[model samples]
Target: MTISLHRSATVLFQGDSITEVGRLVEPDSPLGNGYARKAADRVRSARPDSGITFVNRGVGGDRIADLRARWREDALELRPDVVSVLIGVNDTWRRYCSGSVTSARAFEDDYRAILTQVRDELDAQLILIEPFLVPVRDEQWAWREDLDPRIQTVRRLSQEFGAALLAADGLLNQAARAAGGAEHIAGDGVHPTPLGHTLLAEAWAALAGL
Candidate 1:
């Protein structure tokens, strides 16, 4: 059995495009085509009448530093009871393509700062989601070298912040392996297919015990 989280919680899902998934682009949209939508559905189905609210503040193509830029507007102001973050993929992708690299040290600093602000300023329960790439395409392989360390850093940060860790990267990797490879998830290794979103929802529900 999973640990029971607070009922009627206002959960905020934050991160890059993966988390954004066209949620706001569509009018009257409460969820998207990604894990945010899936996880919100699971929580609502399991805890109906709990009066829980799920907010999606994830923006497309965001990085750790970007999150910091919009923290006050996207996160702090939300006053979430539970905050879930799924970032770091864009950081990896940018660096892999000879793009400007945000050093692992810098990633840690920015990430830690964001979490600290949420913890100290908002007093929200944190959920750190480890971002993953399934190597669906040739370009994705290079991402592992740069991305792995950041994923580890996030995991450790999760512990440091007393946040629930959703090992989505590892879990998705395993799911990919079991499903015959990277194509099982994201065809491009960055975005998730419908199946990938399902796996993420399962992992989140199990972790949050919703």
Candidate 2:
């Protein structure tokens, strides 16, 4: 059965650019212009009386290390009941593009540290979204070698932590295949388009039973 969020629960989303998507840092509009926002909207629409609160702390270009640096401030401090995280793509991207490689072991360690902190400090329910690549460009196919292991790592960690796992990669791939191609979902192979974000929001809502 899908997990149901309690009433008045605070939900937090943490990740990279895909999750960031030009979100306002100001108090008024916290959840960005991506799937996070869409998901929030859907939840409110589905349960207008739930009084659930949502926060988006996703920063563009963030990797696992970056999240580690700001975990206390962005995540723990908020004391959210549910924390949804989408990361790791930038870790893989930096290796190929900038030669700033983060080995799989290191990635898992850093990630586990964040999860451990959340578990110990807040005891919040976790939703781990796997990092995905659509391979819209031929060169993007090579990213599979690095990203796949990280995805597996996330799956293992989710089970270990009793977190809900959102299989975004496979879901998006299937959407892409039905919707003509990856370009329709994520034109850049990394970031999702409006249609892609909608798919993501729907997937999260369904998986989390929001």
Candidate 3:
């Protein structure tokens, strides 16, 4: 199930390039032009008096291990009321682009550490987004072998932690089939197009009760 955000909730979105989306590039735009901003903006506009603050600390090229390495500084320090994580795709991308690969076991271990810390140290809620794929090409279909495990891991973790789950994987697949082609969503089969971001943002906002 999803979460109903409170009035003073501070939502922090964490993950890789998909979540980062050039957030650090422009001086005025700290949240970047992606789902994180879109979702937060939706909530902020709907509830102008919410007093809810949203922070984006996502870094490009970060995998589960990378997030683990920096969680204490980026996440724990922020002390957000709600932590939303969107990782694991790069853990599969690296295996195809480079030789680097993160086993599902390592991914789960690192992911668990961060969640455990949050449970123990902070009074916070968790929102875990599934790493999705909309393969435009035939070869990209093979990525399921690497990505499916991680997606399953996130699903399992969400249930284990009783956190709000954003079921992005199946949504994207449905979008790719019903609305438009995969390219209309994620041209590179990884990075999202504007339409893709909007779709994800709408789903996230619904899940977060924003």
For each candidate, C-alpha RMSD in Å? Answer: 1.6, 1.3, 0.9
TM-score of each: 0.94, 0.96, 0.97
Ranking by TM-score: 3, 2, 1
lDDT of 2 by residue, 1-210 (tens): 255689999999999999988885645557888899999999999999999999999999999999999999999999999999999999999998999999999999999999999999999999999999998988889999999999999999999999999999999999999999999999899999999999999989997675
Runs in model 2 with CA error above 4 Å? 25-28
lDDT of 3 by residue, 38-127 (tens): 999999999999899999999998999989999999999999999999999999989998989899899999998999999999968999
Q: What's the residue-level lDDT of 40 in candidate 3? A: 91
Q: Give the Cα-based TM-score of candidate 3 against the true structure.
A: 0.97
- What is candidate 1's lDDT per residue for 76-175, written digit by digit as tens? 9988888899999899888867687989999999999999999899888888889888887776677789999999998899889998888888788788
Q: Name the weakest run of 10 consecutive residues (lDDT summed) in model 3.
A: 171-180
For residue 191, what is the lDDT in candidate 3?
86
Best by TM-score: 3
